[model samples]
Target: MPSLVAPLMSAGCLAGAPQPSLPVEGGLLLRPWRLADAAAVVRVFQDPDIQRWHLKRADTEAEAREWITRWQQGWQDEVAAHWTVVDADSDAVLGRVSLQSIILMGGQAEISYWTAPWARGAGVCSRAVTAVAGWALSEAGFHRLELGHSVVNPASCRVAVKAGFTQEGIRHNALLHTDGWHDMHLHACVR
Candidate 1:
């Protein structure tokens, strides 16, 4: 397999660490999701909230491995970047974030994030979101970042705002929710 560390730093997502991890506040660290994290990542998907807002089905260990493999490929292609949030003190997987669909015309990309059930409401997602967004703007050369949340997911909307994303507007039937198609609240942050 290709070295994941080199591509992440080359993508402008890290600096000077000679490693994949990005240190954040409150004893937390963010690094690229690896195949080894498949099982834990699948566990995060088991959270109903994660499935609901993320609009994805549950993942088996095999599927998680494949997913991480694809994430690595995306980094190689310069198409997207992914990170696994972990506790710096314990190295426990807490969640994930990806800066995807980067567009230079708009100089923007979409941010997707989720927290393990156990980590909710403790400011983990907020800090990770802010850290990644800051890196994207300051180092990754992105001019704006966007996020969309199902109208019913107030928690995600809260995270977006807490991370400095401004509520832009709502899109009718912008996303398919667990129940059915639903409107999405659009948010954006610009440099």
Candidate 2:
């Protein structure tokens, strides 16, 4: 029998990816999460609106620290990437974005993001999404990037569209939020 592992290992996939800070338009940058960001992470996850959609809450600084550590682990494992959206000039934490469930062999990944409550309605998430997705496609060599949100989340749908993802369809009862099972609107962008 042939060695299946050989082919996969030789694919030059994201086996040991490096996390790099990427600059975006409008004086914003996407950088790796830091331990010092625990306070902001806790604050963002504490918001009822964010918790409602995310279905998880980081109530304490310890929990927030764990969240950042998990992203660091993801980078070490080369399975995902997480970035903290910050103002380039002021260095203020504006939001968070991630390319999760990454499968480098398949050249695919899922994108997710949440904007700080104070940053919402200012197009921060949309701009961050565009920058991250473009980087994942062009720089990272991902062939397809996908994102989905509860169908009730028109704001997220708008952000996905604005970031160049095309709506594929709705998946029934695809995600369970705090409210209950939600139908998710799937969107994707292909390179």
Candidate 3:
């Protein structure tokens, strides 16, 4: 064997390196965002519900391509790690989960998640959150995970609670939602 290292690297696998895929239950996998996912990404942003909560405007086709490009740049910048929640059986995109504002000095990370409107109530966000939190705590070496949601959004608060986060406190006008600035409930989990 003339050192298969080069071939392995080119193929995107190597011993002692991080595995690319994150396996979840029910045949779903959370993985890196792909440029080819622009269509689905646009669909997500086009959703009025997602737009309301995420505080984003509907994206045009050109803007959707730019969105995917930004996603790639985000990973490249170490500013955030974003994942696409995919169905294990059909490989359909179920949602998104991410760790943003990763702070090594404070050993903390901010967690965010969203599921397709159709995937609501199926525990998809919860599962995806658990996986991401585990990765941040263990693999990413984060000691604390923080989550925040507008107090008006009880569904999101419930998701955070279900993911083992402790309700910290309300931050007045913490978030500027589509409606306006709103009180946000902060949650944190220490590993």
Best by TM-score: 2
Worst 10 contiguous positions by lDDT, candidate 3 = 7-16
Residue-by-residue lDDT tens digits, candidate 1, 3-86 = 433322234343323325678899999988878898898898887777777756556999889889988776666667789999
Residue-level lDDT tens digits of model 2 in 12-76: 35544468899988889999999999999888887888988986789999998998999988877
Off by over 4 Å in 1: 1-20
Please give each candidate's TM-score: 0.87, 0.93, 0.85
Error of 3 at 108 (Å): 1.7
Better of 2 and 3 by lDDT: 2
Q: Which of 1 and 2 is the better model by lDDT?
A: 2
lDDT of 3 by residue, 50-75 (tens): 88898665467677668667765655
Candidate 1 deviates by what RMSD?
6.2
- What residue pairs clash in candidate 3, if any at all? 27-88
| Model 3: how far residue 110 lies from native, Å | 0.7
Best by lDDT: 2
lDDT score, residue 38, model 2? 95
